[model samples]
Target: MTATAATAATVLPIRGRLRPLGLGDVRITGGFWAERQEVNAVATLAHIEHWLEREGWIRNFDLAVRGGLAQERRGREFSDSEVYKYLEALAWEIGRNGDAGLESRFRAVVRRVAAAQEPDGYLNTKFGRSGQAPRWSDLEWGHELYCVGHLLQAAVARARTRPGADDGLLEVARRAADNVCETFGPDGIDGLCGHAGIEAALVEFARTTDDDRYLAQAALFVDRRGHGRLSDVEFGREYFQDEQPVRQATVLRGHAVRANYLAAGAVDVAVEQKDAGLLDAVRNQWQNAVTRRTYITGGQGSRHQDEAFGGDWVLPPDRAYSETCAGIGSVMVAWRLLLADGDPRYADLIERTLFNVVATSPSADGRSFFYANTLHRREVGTLPDADRPSLRAAASLRAPWFEVSCCPTNVARTLASLTAYVATSDDDGLQLHQYMPGTIEHRRADGRELRVTVTADYPTTGRSGYVSRATKLPATLMFLGRCRCGYPDGRPRARR
Candidate 1:
């Protein structure tokens, strides 16, 4: 990976106030995130793979190939997305450091997935089979589009990291994306996904492929939302964000994960199309959510019944249902906003969520994971059985796996590519957003290069310093704490 791979970041806006560096440009050399990255690479990825195989989620792809999926499908309707997310994590880890073993595992999984694709590019085990539901039959809960979205995202990761590898994952994803565009174009299905992730994934796919059709499809999805196109559920249309137009909605509502995913996609579309109105709408929603609905730990949502957010300021600490996936979604939204607007406040919220919600989900060994993160635990939690999946989503204790295990894979992908979130570059100079022991190396568009080594024992000592050379332009390093210009030799300033 090279400095030119900055376009390979998870969220590479076509144009923004800042440019995010990719895993290639930033390296976590030591300290907090470095340790997390080490554990993620050494333990978390393998653990997820083991459970995915044990739970039969990975085998679901093989069943799809053998035409036994309708009878043998194991996981939930959305289980296929988990496999894609795992592949994405592998792509990033492999890109960061060429892991031959993980590389072999990645290609193996991709082969299984490739064999399942329908002739017309449709792929999924839960629908359009001998005994399964027809494709797109249940728009409210099918998650067919949602699965394809994850597939496209995995392909994007592969394409960026491996560029034209022989694994065939990229081709599989391209076919699926083409199918989506053709099937859901403006004249096609007027309905949008019951879930909101496909929107952002489509936009990113569009960016990756340089195809505006996918972008148009993503825009269509964003516009089609808030129109009550899908049937009302027991939880109501807001659960899917279909009750109000995205551009007109003032605050994020309904399912916390769905709300933030929709907002992140909307920001992508707005930035690509230069839709200021849409951008402002999303910004306002972020502000309102932060001011009212957000927890001090940067968690979102309170209603465990629907896994949705409560009405303005209706937070209950004991009953807080800050799903870990929702926290990741909130980071997705804020990171995009930070790049688009270059606001340090967005980074502040990101740091809070990263330290509290993201880090809190995984146990120390990186094996057990928390599906739902409650701010206060009213009861002492019994140790979950390490051998079995915990059926409880709100369990007080960390579980090795969940029946619906989205967070573990989500954490895997995020941590594998965590270095991308630490730094950004611009025409003027560089900006280091999060401080950890690391090295940031970037090349400007003009061919000049900058390398900076950061040293810190952050959160423990509240002190960090950076030494930068090989650059004539001034670098702006954002510190959440106060800055002391003169400390310990008056050369490198202390940020405390």
Candidate 2:
């Protein structure tokens, strides 16, 4: 069967039910090109280059660089993680739109950075010195391994998407992964990092490299957490560790970004390992957090200090410190959870965050960015200063980028991969979780055309619906039921 007819038939099981859809069918303003432009790629690469040069994010060789890891400052030492993010961004841009100069420049920077690696396969500019610690020694704060993971993933992305792409980056990633496995195995270093990025990155690397060792290493990291194996520091030992088995943790705790990243990584492990218990835990934690602690803007981590979640209903929209990264992290968790359980509510959270908070981060020009976005506004004393300029300005569609601007590039990558979150299936049928105006082309087992044209103005109008016009044979039609309704009155009455 054709994709459209299959989709129509898939809907028949829940003809009267409502389900949410993923970004596969959702189209944001500016689309992929707009995302690239905001990140200063393709049509806007040159302009972004000029701005980055002026802002000092780029060096003499057109290599992307950042000041440091501490509170947004200038003239601090350049971080390997910062460079890795930029390389990932550049690789993504090149993958989408082939630019010889950009690709060459990216490769050159990678080579230079590779040259900085030690003979032990360790690669990081910030901590490779006589007085410094070993590569993975300082897991509590240092992001060297995390940086390597990003580089590895970026290399994989470049290799898969770009023509004539070399395996240099891939080899580097392998070496890095090997180093990590050697250093942090069960008999190796008995610790994890305060930040939980490397686990997710390692999982991606394992998938790309087809190496089970990488996957095992990722699982070990998840399993070892909360056991006091990864070290205990300023954030408290429990901050990094989930305390109980991942399945037992009831609510998201500790550093916001770290918790979410770990949760997402754990979900990845659960799905790949087919651990039903772990998946159930993830769903429980997600529902608990969203219903109680999550911001109305779909933002998490209410505290500005640790960027962690507050108590239930403790959401202070005016004083909201909803970090852009946390919003992105929530989307990642939601998307993966959606794929795991085929639940529409997960997609609902993803859509809400994407449209209102995530979309509001980048300016139209793609230069300035908002690290923190709030849902409401308040005047400070008598000065009337903007409470959350990021959200407000972004809502008004202002600047393109920001000082601590990882959020912009992060959003770019997420939007590019938005196509992956559309639909899912079990042995029974497919589920449509989101309603947007787009065509889904899927082939049915019976060799028919199952094209589904979604027609709806979601989050805007209450009466949006879908029309699945079949091309070959009449198939079953089902509605998964609305997973959520932005309107307080519940599901919008379906219009004819």
Candidate 3:
């Protein structure tokens, strides 16, 4: 318990606060959850890369490297985000299992991404190419900054997990981030993105590189919303969290993923700036969203038209547009808030979304995925392709590909990085967020080392059979916040 020993201990996110157990910090030896992650590595990691290439996302990168869009961009505007997300999955999968094959594939993709970067550090295959929109020109729906955000996240993951990469992916991210800082600001474009992803990524970029410019940019974007900058969009003021600033919004409104992602970034900004008002505002909005708007399966959006949220108490199960990506966004937001103050409540929704929405998105084989998760199905129709059934939200069967293929990669990355959500450390001891059977290791702030072995059957029947072996047992932190809790056979209990 010496000072040197404490300083030598590895730290988790949000330094000196309670440390959330990282991927390496906890090992899932075996169980249901462990099976899923193993499949994510063996089945999902390679499958998604194949889908990206066959779906033309990797081709888009190649075409961008040639400085033209002669093919007119095969997929959606935000297609590049899928590539970045898949790279993130690769980073974690490599961390879990030192797959030389995947590492080689990762490096190759990084080189290709480097070749695609513009001289000025701008990236986004859909822009700056011939017969396409100019760089950052269509901020309202361009998704230029959104793509930048995912790339930054992937870069940070690579740098953290793969130390010897040195393949320039981190530098590509840094240069791109610097370009964003220069382009959008007070004296620059004077507007933030129509999407809310970049703010969180900028803050994370600052944390990873020790750069204040990224933090400032994150704050700039956080404050820039709700000032009518993106008011003229398709969904009016509410579409992209531009309806009101983060500190003033009472409930999560408009696009489900956008609202959740922006709220998450707002929490990161508030934590860094020590702005309690902003933090309180985000917490308040989270309360309202979960209680009145969210579905029983922890899904967010209720409409497909704008892929947006509906009014309070308007959550209809069958008509839900609960994008799998939104479920991932909810986990990201809740995890940050949990790290902010060591509150066990944030872990509640993370578990709900993880089990019900995210876990359900992919099938057992991981060859296909669900774009939007629906709770109920009136009729399960037959299809020519058994893997691709027609149903509400997404296909009844998990389709191998989609015109908008965001969810598949999102699910991949989330499952690949699942352990980071499992446990945490306070000065006193550890806290268990999810009860999956696993092994966890942590060094307390005081330099005391503890290793925990957990055994439990989670998300099946009641959570009564659970056991742990450690220096001290962590309080079983149940996720009971902003929503109702219930059990079948006629016992319905609401959380207080």
lDDT of each: 0.89, 0.59, 0.78
**lDDT: the better of candidates 1 and 2:** 1
- 1 or 3, greater by TM-score: 1
**Candidate that would win on TM-score:** 1
Cα error of candidate 1 at position 167, Å: 0.9
Kindly give the stretch of ten consecutive residues in candidate 1 with the minimal lDDT sum.
Answer: 481-490
**Tens-digit lDDT track of model 2 for 305-409:** 666787778888876777777888888788777666655667778777877677777656555556677776664322212332232223323345444445655
lDDT of 1 by residue, 184-300 (tens): 997787788898898899888888878889889999999999999999999999999999999999999999999999999999999999999999999999999999999999999
Ranking by lDDT: 1, 3, 2
TM-score of 3: 0.90
- Cα RMSD for candidates in order: 2.2, 7.2, 4.5
* Residue-pair clashes, model 2: 45
The residue-by-residue lDDT of candidate 3 on 1-496, one tens digit each, is 1112112111234543566666657777777788999888989888878877877788888887665565646777888998999988888777777789989999988888888898989988888777776888888888999999999988877766765468898899999998998898668989888888988888877877778799889999999999888857667889987877788899999999999999988888888888899999998998899899999888999889888899999988777778898988888888888888777667888888898999888889987777788777688833425433233344555777676777878888888778777878776677777878877776664666777776666556435223445566354445455446633223565644
Alpha carbon deviation, residue 409, candidate 1 (Å): 0.3
